[model samples]
Target chain A: MKFIVSIKMVPDVYAPFQIKDGELLMDGDRTVLNAYDASAVEEALVLTEKHGGDVEVVCIGSAKASETIRKALAMGAAKGYHIQTNGDETYDSSSYAQILASFLSDKEYDILSFGKQSQDTDSGLTGGMVAQLLNLPYATNAVGLEIEDNKLVVKRQGDSGQEMIELPTPCLVTCSNDMNEPRIPNLKGIMASKRKPVESLSVSDLGVDATALEAVSKVTSYEPVPARAAGKKFEGEPEEIAREVAQLLDTEANVL
Target chain B: MSTLLTYVAISDGKIKRSSLEVLSHCKSIADAGGMACEAVIIDENATSYTDDVQKYGASKIYTVEGDAFKQHQNGSLLKALTKVNEVAQPSLIAFASTEGTKDVLGALAAQLKAGVVADVSSFNFDGTKVTAQRPMMAAKIMGNVNVTGNPVLVSVRSGSYDLKENPATAEVVSVDVTVESGDLRATLREIISATGDTIDLNEAEAIVAAGRGVKDEEAKALISELASVLNAGIGASRALTESGVYDPSLQIGQTGKVVSPQLYIAVGISGAIQHTAGMANSKVIVAINKDADAPIFEIADYGIVGDLYKILPTFIEEIKKIKN
Candidate 1:
């Protein structure tokens, strides 16, 4: 069993940022492995380690993304494929999916995985798009993964419940961050990661039509979410305030 | 005239109210733009939902029914949606953002070669282009997006719009789509339904969410009692879910289900940004925690600083009294 998990380096959503003139401003250097992708990589590594296989990672970003790939390598991924981009192009989920599809078109692997959605945009589109392009059996929002008798069984979070799905080889899955906690790189693993092989390629190198990679959707501006004003606070006897608020819910708030 | 098609989602044998909300918005858009408003219901009992869909003003309804459509299998759903798209030739397709929609939205858009925007809070589709506002960076910021395609696709978040009734005489059309077993590359082995009869959090009018401070079975019982009184869905923060105190299906946060019920009650939960991101859109928020400065209080419409053990019993009793 061979695993190729698509990884990404995304803006640290926790970093303080500002919106001015409909533009989002944040520290460009503050980037990290997407948490959901890290979970995908972690799950793949766990499965391959127990099942006597190897885990590899693929990422699409600028040269700085090699650091992200290295982080996965430190988590014991055997190899990395860096699909280099200009880092300035306003690529949407579709563009990234096309690039990944083109790169994986000629590759061999048993399972393909991705984060359920990007940390920054949270569009959650690319994995299914790539799966469609490659015509593979796929599942999304996977909270758990298991390999059984040459099949990938996924426990995916659905609207109503957790659906246990089984996909044959050459399948795709998008992992949710709820799956598992990603392992931090140990000192020895970090040193080994520095020596791990990282194969780099440009989008043009994949033979995908440049026009097809053009973004069909563009983010025109960024705006702050409407703030919810804090309301009345009640700090008194438990029974008194509790009854008071309950009355307010029915009378004042009209919700009850 | 071009058509605006809304996909009516069915979950647990009932049509999702969020889907009707999306249909209502699309109907208004179609009425204002002089375009045809249509709907597609793909379910085991798709035709049974036509009357309910008609109430939302869809002039034409497409039904793709079969046992294959019983559970959400992306392969069968994609095939059915493709056939409907071909028959409807809609200029824009709208959906209520659900886990099912998230599973197949990308693949459907890719198959159709259409532009797509996912989990948008609000969207507008003119004759040519579609513009949408979607939450980004864990709902801390909103991104205004412009989409271009012959048939643009968009999925709106639940509670983004109010449901409106605009009755119409709908022409029902049955779409024929046979999904061979060979085409279903993935097989559903089983479904682990954690919340069997509990109200779905996404559709609940009110939610009672337990956090770390809800430690013991006693507290859990109190939480359940409170929910029972208010008819609210039970939810949990990641802490409770990860610790196995609550089912993962009931976890509400950035990495879990995002909910916007009319009323949200947080019990013993210190409000983290990740948890707050999911429920910040609730119409009225009430947080009860011993910590006076808990961040959940920042956005809570009614912040009660008290111990859950003491507060919940009184809260439940008071609500029950009000109801009687």
Candidate 2:
């Protein structure tokens, strides 16, 4: 079995961000691999460990994305594929899906995995759209998985409850944090990653269709979210605080 | 501009509130363009919901009734929706940001060769363009998106749009479709129930959340008691969920579920940015923490500087007394 995990580099959510000239200025912010993508990489490594195969990590970003891929390599990926793009290109889910689908169409891989949602965009659409483009069965928000014969059994999060389902091989799975704990890279693994193989490709190299590359949605402007106003504060005995809160809920919130 | 179509999600023989909210949102977009707005419902009891959806301002309702919808067969549902789209010729299609609708909308967008905006908080339209305000970077930054596709698709975040009762007489249209078993690539095996009520955090009216300050599993009872007194849902910060003190389903953070309840009370929570991102859009927020400078207090509408263990029980008692 062969696995491909797609990862994205995102700014730390806790870091303060600014909007300048109608665009988000990521300047001075540290960028790291998306936290959820770590679970996808870990799930792929575990699958490879059990089934005796190699795991390849793929990412779509600028040249710096190789560093993000290197982190996955240090964790245990055998190779890395970076789809090189400029830093400012705005590709919506459809265009991103088209790029991944076009690249993976000619490649021979058993399973393609992604994080359930990206920390930056939180679109949660790429994996499913890729599956649709490739006309393959896919599962979203997978928390558990097991390979049985030629089928993959998965536990997925649903609206009302958790759903256990089965799909054939060559399927796409978007892994959530509940899947497994991602392992941190040790000194030995970091040293080994320096010698690992990494490849880069462009849209022209893959012969991607021009129509597929057209972005239908673009960010028109960016703004910092308005901070909530500081409201009434109560500091007193527990009973007094409770009474005040109860009164506030009744008068202001109307939830009492 | 052409018509707007909204997918109304139904479960357990009734329409979900999130879907009605989206339908109302779609109606506003349609009215802005001087076009029609319709709703598509795939369920066993689609016709039973015609009057309910009409009350929310759907001018036309397409109900595709079958057993396949009982378990959310996305492939079949997409096929039915496509058939309706071909007839309706909608320029914009909307779905609520629920698990099933998101799944279907993703594939449906690919099949229709349309552009998509997911989990939009708000949207505006001129004569020619639709601009969407999306909470990006874990709700830390807001991005104004301009959609320029021939047909646009969007999934609206729950609680982002207020539900307004704009009554309209709806013309019910029945869509007959056949579901081939062979077309299904996957099947729902079983739905394992999680602890507590089935109300998802995204749809909860009120939420009482706990954090690492609660210390132990036994301390969670205080939070639950407060939630019960307020008739709210129970949630937990990522720290408690990651520590295995609570189920991940109850987790609220950047990596977990984003929620927008009418009233959100954070007990024993330090208000990490990631956790606040999940509930910052809530209507009214209240925080109870021992530390006066906790970040949660910055966004809280009401703040109490006290120990939650001491504050929660008395708060619950006071709320109960007031309610009675």
Candidate 3:
């Protein structure tokens, strides 16, 4: 079995972001592979270890994304593939999906995996678009998977419970945040990653014509959210507070 | 100018509150354009919801009823809407931005080879052009999206539009259709039940949520008070519910319930992605936290940097006065 997983490098949610007000701020201390995509990397490792096959990680970003490719190599990916771009422009979901779809259209890979959503886009739109473009089976929020009769038996997340979905070998699965625990890389693996194969590709090389795709809306600016108004704590008997609460609910919210 | 509006309906055997909110939003857009607004529903039987559909201001109800149409079958829905657009030739298509609706429509747009204006807070028209407001960069920035296409795809963020019953009589029109092989091929195997009350969080417009920062005694009081005041349901963070500070049924996050309400109030929350993933689609977010640096502040439209204990009583009084 051959597996291909998509990975992305994102800012640490805890650290104040690097790009604020459409201007450059110094990059912060920590940057990691996306949480869901990390699970995709780990799942590939687990499956490769059990089935004895090749696992590769792919990403579309600036040269800075190599930081995560190195992480994936340390986590046991056999090779790293990066398609570098010189611009800071962020493509909308449809355009990004088209670029990736074109990249994978001719590749004869058996399994394709990606994170369910990306925080920067929080739109949860890419993975499914790739599958639709490829005309292959697609599933989201796959928590578990197993190989049986040359098909993939998977567990998908629903609003409240789990659902089991089955698809053939050439299928796409998007990993949810809770899919699996991510593996930590040790010093030995970190040192060994430099020796692994890393290939660089470009949008021009892939025949990507980005000019045809237009942006309907642009994120012109960002501001720190305003603070909330003060809340008043009521101290009294539970029943008394409850009655006042009821009055407040009716008068203010018009709920009662 | 033209406008597109989308309504989300919660179906078990019928349409729900979220559905009307979507319609009211479209009514606003249509009123601006001086055009007819149509409400579309996907269900097994169309007539079950006729009276309420028009009572809620939908001048017309377009329903595709049958087994294939139930619970948002993405493939069939995409096909059905394509036919509807071909027939109606409307200026815009609107959606109510439900969880499944967002996912399904996002995919549908890619399938239809169209761009989507997602989670619009509000929209305006000027006889020939339409402009709508959207939140990006995780709700910190408010941006305007202009639609130039003849028929654009737009979805209203949950709780963004207030619902009203205009009560104009309208008739229901049904479309006959079939499910396709490509449609049934995706992974929508089943709909599982959440922990307790089986309450549909997606249908709620007002949500009151509490977190671990809520000092113990105040934790329980917060829910009861907020729910009573807002006529809203209660929700809690996984941390608080796991430590027995609250019931698990109230837990909201990546592993719990995902809700999109009109007014989302966070009490004592630190605003981790786990919790934000559940309610980031809200129309208005207000956070009350003592820690000014809490991540919840990153997404809050209004954040009160004070002890909730010192804040809730007075705030509630102020709200009462404002409304009165």
* Candidate 1 backbone collisions, by pair: none
Docking quality of model 2: it rates as medium
Residues B294-322 of candidate 1: C-alpha lDDT, one tens digit per residue: 99999999999999888888889889989
State how far residue B239 of model 2 sits from its true place (Å).
Answer: 2.4
Model 2, residue pairs in steric clash: none
Instruction: Give DockQ: model 3.
Output: 0.30
Residue-level error in angstroms, candidate 1, position B316 = 0.7
Tens-digit lDDT track of model 1 for A1-256: 8999999999999999999999999999999999999999999989988998889999999989988999999999999999998899888888988889989999999999999998889899999999999999999999999999999999999999999999999999999999899999899999999999999999889998888878889999999998899999999899899989999999999999
How far does residue B194 in candidate 1 sit from its true spot (Å)? 1.6
- Candidate 2 interface RMS: 1.5
Residues B1-324, model 2: lDDT tens digits: 577788888865557788888888878877877978888888887898898999989989988888877777667787788788887777788888887876677778888887778889887655346789998987888889988654688888889888988999999999887778666788778887675464567778999998878896557888777777878888899888778787777888776777898999998899988898888989899998899999999999999999877887778888998889
Superposed on the true chain A, the predicted chain A of model 1 yields a TM-score of 0.98
DockQ-based CAPRI category assigned to the predicted complex of candidate 1: high
| Candidates' C-alpha lDDT | 0.94, 0.83, 0.68
Tens digits of per-residue lDDT, candidate 2, A80-121, equal 999998866767877778888888998888888889888888
Cα-based lDDT at residue B173, candidate 3: 68
